[model samples]
Target: MKNKGSRRRPNKAAAPRKGEAASDGAGGDRLSKLPDDILLNILERVDTLDALRTCILSKRMLKLPTMLSRFDIDVGNLARHHDAASYGYTLNHVIQYNNAVAGVAEKILSARNLEIPIRKLRLRFYVGRDGCLSISKAFACTMATQRVDNAEFVLLTEKSCLKCTHDNLLYYAQQFNNCLGDYPAAFAGLTHLWLRNMRFGELDIPNVLSTCKRLVSLRLSNCDAGVRSVLHIEHAQLVELCIEEGKFEAVQLNGLPKLQHVNFVGWCCPDPLTFRSVPQLRKLRLEQIGISSTKNLQLSQFLANVPWISDLHLDFRSEKIWVLPESPKLLAPVLGKLQIVNLDNLPEGCDMAWTMFILEAAPSLRELCITVWDDWCKIVTDKEFRRKNGYCEKANVEWQPSDFDLKHKNLVKLTIHGFQPDVIFVRYVRRILEVAVNMGDISLHDRKVCERCMDLDPEIKVCPSRYPRTTEEKDMLKVEITKELGMASHAVIHFRS
Candidate 1:
């Protein structure tokens, strides 16, 4: 690395001369003294184009870094070439871009032979409809022969999807199918693999899962494919697996003994799980799945086996509700460990007792969200349902919440939707606050008169003037008042003291 520019004058403390002028030719002196290793490191950090330009700077920096163990060849950089269409350059520039990339790739691949024991190799290519199939075949050929420790394949472009009549998109999808034959050997050492928006054809997912023994994490999202074999795992090395929005059937979980987290979304399977397949499973999720029905779902038995589950989100709208047992004792043991529960459109008559079960089982619960049948859960007035027996008033709550709070002291937050809090609801809130001294947050939706400003605030004297402090104005603004309270009730949020 030779110094190209003039250096500054020497400091007064060190390199001062006796008779030579302060502006002596010592300007270039300090830069020449820098070691070769530091300059080489600086040059290696530049982009590949700029790194190649360094060859013009000095003969010594012309050769690429020998110690470089990792290299990424990106075709996106070559795609930036500006060419005028008036000069008869429609696909000509694309051809030039492809040729330039191929030339660079050849040089890099040849260099890899000399840089033996290359740890990581990354190739990212973007191809339009005009990209030659020969080029894709050559790229796949290189990957099969190269050593790739970690790989990411992203095929995302309108050209790749091929909106026009050409077979470009189909060709792109078939490339992955062709690459699968070499996947075992090419990606044997791979620790992480991510494939996104890929149109895959004839890739054996089960074979890939089995062959990639060193794989610890795998993610495939928005892959376009037809019904492939249900993903079966014969390996236990996988720690995390995520499959979302693709074509696949029942995923066999038998082989993943060490698997901790598994996410399967939009996976249309008649049965999502088989017995004892995932014993070590910690988190299981099924969202927006197309299950024909929820009849005879052995839900409790399944929950009993998955004791480590701390969060469960299941959207079972495809199945009928009210089929399961409705007592706390039946569900509390399994649900006791649950920290978050989200249920939508629960069958009628499922709300009142289901809430009690939650309060019992998940005492450590921080948040509870439930959709209830408002028309059915009537508010039994205070005059009714008095404890007739020797049992204390706390023993019986006709939808009273104080009883719920006494046991679930840690219950800090509640979210209720579609439940109109009549007199019963108000008492429930009062009791819930009693137990939750820290008084967590609450959210209510689709309520009619939960806001105090609508009706209760007039009685409380908070907003007396504009909000119809008078009785007649309050009657005229009854609807607004009702809307406000309903919103507040839906949230069940604790109000200011």
Candidate 2:
């Protein structure tokens, strides 16, 4: 943004004229030396209008922008440009902002005459005033003229912005809906899609998937449908799916054949994560997830159907901790292929036992990383936060792992975080090293403290708090685990802050 005292220069970019010469015309020029395809690919990375602006440079580059496989129509941040941000939202400022939106839509419509298919398209526009519905219909008309493989359409309403009121945003969406007809007819070519903010208002997710059978990957993040609609997903060509920060009542995932990756983050409500016959699912991540159903939302059930999941990461925040119990059906596949596992937010005094239970099940595990939050440590030092979150900071109980001698043969590397020097914790580590004959390397790290945690509650103490784990405490645990486990003299062990 430029101040009035330092006015920005006017646009020097002109429309493409015939027989224009390059600014510097040697064959050794950096841009001209590249092949025609490479030059076109570089232009595709920019916005369509910005790409056209380059046509003023040379005549040979004029025809290359029309071959762009990707198109982006962004208007959210355009209001912050020099012309629009010089003053407050007065009458003149609002006119300039609306003109910027029309300019972006016009550039996208120009691609219709090129005839080449758009492999990927992303359009982000604001919906606030009278022209929003017309803009939406013009966008659909442009879609009807061209074929697209991957497309994302985001209509940012007033609910998502602070400058406009909710009534104005809802009116714009309602107006757009009254005129939007047969939009599903254009989904025949869309395979990959991502929608934000606009949910069932303009598009029903279930109906869209049912109509578009060729969809491979779908992501719905921060959408109203997650809270308002019931999503019924069943596709044969779908491979990857992600639903982040949604509150859906019933999200049914059924009969996805080629599905390999699934990421569901921040399930605010207690909804069941249904899994119906996904055999090829491999990689899975559930972060900041909590379910209301204690029985149906079990990890064992999700793993029983999918046998080939190799890499797994789970970060849970819930009323109860999930125990890794022995299951013949799940253990058979996990023992054969499961290689890497990362577990975070593991509660102290109760999670060590679960670690052994997991090791017994996955005999082929190559790497294991666990993040433990010392419950007693936090209470004794940082009591206010624990109390604020309804956690019992003062409740006293003794806990230890169940007896097991199962050989975790393939485990060669291990990293344990939030290491404490208590007697019970040291014994748990000693027993694992004794049974795990192929132990190669182990690293124990102190707890990690972030700025947010320290800023939120000043009463809580940071690492090396009132009761810090001294060097003597760390040394005692290392020495005992190594000596009792009968580990080789050359095996490596490290302790770090």
Candidate 3:
């Protein structure tokens, strides 16, 4: 039966609801007509709690919905329909929410009777006074007997929740004391794990990573693990590690034989990170990271320690690094093994020294990617999210090709997205064209208007290939670039909007 005031969904058949026998003559819906995997895909999109509610009272719902593998629920949407900011709200609604959580746990426990494994499960919900103690127990019972490869449990604190009340937040903070030890013991087979906004006791880090013997990737975001002291992380099987949105005084990364990638974002280490015995690391990505080097450590020293790095992405666009001025010679360290380099971020606007540093350090580099957004992200706070969707503007710089490598003969492909014609950007473009001898058609694209920014700034111009859009700004810049870049008559320059 359809509920009142609900918008009409597509006329698709659904799986049989609880208490209905598969052999019953009344259940000939199209949902039961499809294969089990397709039905599970459709169910994965709905709130996981809805499935639990429908099967709550049925004695035959012991094995859960057939072939249902992935489940996700967003607790933040609990009162999205109506403004819960009302003072008239009472304890009855809170109790009902708690009961709903307990009910879902009971339903998940029914997965014990299944033969197939749950591949992925994600829960982005609030952790009120009781936290996820009940749900974790349910997972311990069911997941211990089955396989769940990927899991993300984000416990939203009151500060992160806009609609939650102070009273409710107090309850959640007091109850969210569960640690990695509270998890299922079957985690030995898990490959990927992400925990956000959770407290980590002194030993939780090692215990969690070691428990998942096969865990290949791990992420910790906005986590509390006594960051004031040095935190050491070591694992034999871990290949990728990420720490973001938090500040740590110091970190020691050691003894990971197979580790390949390390990503750090919005992280500040007062003492430079100490890398112990990671010999197999091949890739490193640092974004908006702040490092106060007391030991006068050159960034190149860090690169030299990882001799096999093939790809490097250093995004310094978000946070400011002030010590860059004191160390203009930081880039000429040792990057001879690097093949690809992404230096698209502009620290304190653009600088010619950084570009010269990477080019001189990495002589074997083949490809370069740069962008110039229209400075819109800086002007409009409402559209700030556009920056994350690949909308960026190149910083204007006065680059002197003579002071550095005059001929970058190795670069074969050059892509310049969002070609803005400011004096600084024009200078940077002309400099690159002059140096890259083996370069092909220089791909010049205009600014991109994101889905949200499109209505406000309709030009929406950006091309991967060397072709100009029909916008007047792009057409005019195309001709100007042809004249200014000074490319030979035989050289082809693709102008794109």
Q: Which predicted model would earn the best TM-score?
A: 3
Q: How many residue pairs collide in each prediction?
A: 15, 0, 13
TM values, all candidates: 0.50, 0.67, 0.68
The segments of candidate 1 whose C-alpha lies over 4 angstroms from its true place after superposition are 1-151, 155-173, 196-203, 222-229, 275-279, 289-298, 301-304, 314-327, 340-359, 364-406, 409-497
lDDT of each: 0.50, 0.60, 0.57
lDDT of 2 at 235: 86
Model 2 lowest lDDT segment of ten: 392-401
Model 3 lowest lDDT segment of ten? 319-328
Model 2 CA deviation exceeding 4 Å by range: 1-64, 80-119, 126-147, 160-182, 197-203, 222-230, 268-271, 289-297, 317-337, 347-351, 372-403, 415-432, 439-457, 464-481, 484-497
Cα-lDDT of candidate 1:
0.50
Give the per-residue lDDT digits (tens) of candidate 3, residues 395-491: 3333443345467778776666655456555566666766777777667665545565434544534233223456675656555655655547125
Off by over 4 Å in 3: 1-37, 41-64, 77-102, 105-113, 161-179, 182-190, 198-201, 212-214, 270-272, 289-297, 318-333, 344-353, 372-405, 445-476, 482-497
- Candidate 2 has a TM-score of 0.67
Residue 178 local lDDT, model 2: 44
RMSD values for the candidates in order, in angstroms, are 15.3, 10.0, 10.1
Across 120-217, the per-residue lDDT of candidate 1 in tens digits comes to: 54445433443433334444445566655554333323332224222443454555445545334544555555554455444455566666667777
Residue 402's lDDT in candidate 3: 31
Summed over model 2, clashes come to 0
